[model samples]
Target: MLIDVAIEKVKGLISFFEGYRETGFLEALQIAKEIALEMNIDATFRKRRKIKRKKQFDENPDDTNIAPQSAQESFRVNYFIRVVDQAISSLTRRFEQYEGYQKIFGFLFTSETLRSLDKDSLKSSCVNLEASLTKDKQSDIDANELFVELKSLQNFMPKENIGPVEILNFLKRHDCFPNASIAYRVLLTIPVTVALAERSFSKLKLLKSYMRTTMTQQRLNDLATIALESEVLEKIDYEDIIEDFISKNTARMRMFK
Candidate 1:
């Protein structure tokens, strides 16, 4: 159920972005802020309810584990309230850092404005993009020329075709605008959740059971990696792997012969 809620929240964020793709960054930011506000309100309500229930639970000493109904209700309320609090905290942190994201990816997200941006606006965006880059990456390209190339590409490309992937493909195809491509690549690599890490820990528990308590960390990591990527591993040809193994080792070849 928590996963479902998380998925729904992601979906909401995607939908919000999609709807505001052609609009400017300000519009998108407003939508996001509204969504976050709604979530905050819901979280505040849940927190208050949790506090009231906790107070009730504390006030009646006899009610503490005396009745399964009261105890179960308390546990359920506490666990759910914790989940809500976590979700709220995550959203709040994202909101706090939103301005930086807007500065970096704002132009990429606003497809409609890309082609129409005048020299001053494009220059400002270029400065913002360069400011966001690391010192090593910052020195490697001319932001002004990259902005010129971006404007030229935007002139030829349809507004609808202007997106992160489309722009990336355009840059790669033309071998132009290295800085812009790198910025987009950085944006693409940013993770939205810790679900993958959580899954890894879960896999670790399964692989390193009580009986396997003495397993080395290196061996456990290898096993967990294999387990996590089993879908990809399943597609590999084990027969080919065995043949290659035999070809690489004289002992294996002799044994097989």
Candidate 2:
């Protein structure tokens, strides 16, 4: 995913939540009233028992006629505004990592972005990438080697109608550009969301049931893989598999043929 684009989306959501916080009270009240109307009931807050306490040492005891909050005011202050504030705060906190992600991987976002970089900028990007990935004196790729390889790679790749996916495919076929391959592999394998991981966990609940108590770990893993990857399994040619299964010997091959 494009880091800048993702960051913009997160910002947009926060802005929307802020706008809601400012002007959403009356609208929320209206919706509550409408729901109450549909149910043939009054939209009202339950009255609390009035309590009296000693005034503060500096306070006037004569001032005791505090107006109780109306249901609209109570709900607005207690629920609507608080919920919207939480939404804004949570959004800001959750997506803050996107900015750091952009800094590390922004230059490799697209084919056009990569191709447009001048040599000096590209070299700087490689150096920065090396720094980000370096740990305990080990590095994924040599920055200078990656710089030279990418410069040579740009000359032969198509100017349009391509992105990192296509570039990775090229690397796969030729097995050249080791540094570029590592970089692109890391770039492409970044998890955009946790939905797939969540789904795998969900699948485990269904796959390892009471009846499957005795299943071996390896067999369970294989079953989970096949069950989760049913889309890929659907596209496989069953006839080819059947033929291959049958042709295990000369007699079997002759019979199948």
Candidate 3:
């Protein structure tokens, strides 16, 4: 789906480039890179094949003897390469999009409400996003204004660049200015990733040598979820969340507990 959209974007820009030389060339190149990166072509195929082959070999010692473990090592290397390629591509696309958005949308989010950003500032936000994804917590940087700005732009024209005060006024008159408050609330509001807890348990291995890798997968999962969600989860009753989830996913109470 993302690929299709990117392809269309490229196609759309093809003719539009006639009037724009360097700028168009650069933007089009970027779009092409993003489209290529977002295309996770090998994930499904490689994962399935790896699982299937492992299962088949497990079921038949004779078959495993035929291929040798060396062949499996080759597969592992190839899978690793694909993973690295995908990660690099993903990072490139993210940084590009963050930069692109800043070029197009930063005007709407200047001042302390949003940090005054240069190109480096946009790059800094991307770094923060990556650290947050990997560490699963907010980075020290001020990104709330930028985040709120992105959310607000969801409905606005991407190609347009209006002033910051104009945007604030639009939101204020329309009762969206209070988003500033909401954005502040979300800085540490949710468990967007499990990496934080994962890192913590990984630290546990340091203190307990016998349990270096002894933690079961299920136990690890539970630990990570609890660590990340503990603060917010403790504050709110589960019943309310269950009710909200049920309300969103079902039409009637009979479908929920």
TM-score of each: 0.48, 0.79, 0.21
Off by over 4 Å in 2: 1-4, 39-41, 52-58, 61-68, 209-221, 244-257
Tens digits of per-residue lDDT, candidate 3, 33-123, equal 5776699433221222334344553476665567434443454356544554565565455445544544433333433323344555554
Give RMSD to native, each candidate.
Answer: 14.0, 3.4, 22.6
lDDT of 3 at 97: 56
Clashing pairs in 1: none
In terms of lDDT, the poorest run of 10 residues in model 2 is 59-68
| Per-residue lDDT of model 1, residues 1-257, tens digit only | 12223445655655554444334344534565688798874322222232324446347676555533454345335754455456556665655455456556667653565776787888888777776674955454457876877777677666574556666776777675777677667655554467777998889889999999899989988999899999999999999988998999899899999
User: Which segments of model 3 are wrong by more than 4 Å?
Assistant: 1-69, 113-257
CA shift at 230, candidate 3, in angstroms? 28
lDDT score of model 1? 0.65
Model 1 clashes, total count: 0
Considering every candidate listed, which one attains the maximal TM-score? 2
Write one digit per residue (lDDT tens) for candidate 2, span 1-257. Answer: 54556688888999988998988777877898899999999787777777678678887656666677876688778988889999888888757777777777777776677788899999999999999889999999999999998888777677784767888898788777999999989877776667878999999999999998999999999999999999999999999998888877788888867
Which residue pairs clash within candidate 2? Answer: none
Candidate of highest lDDT: 2
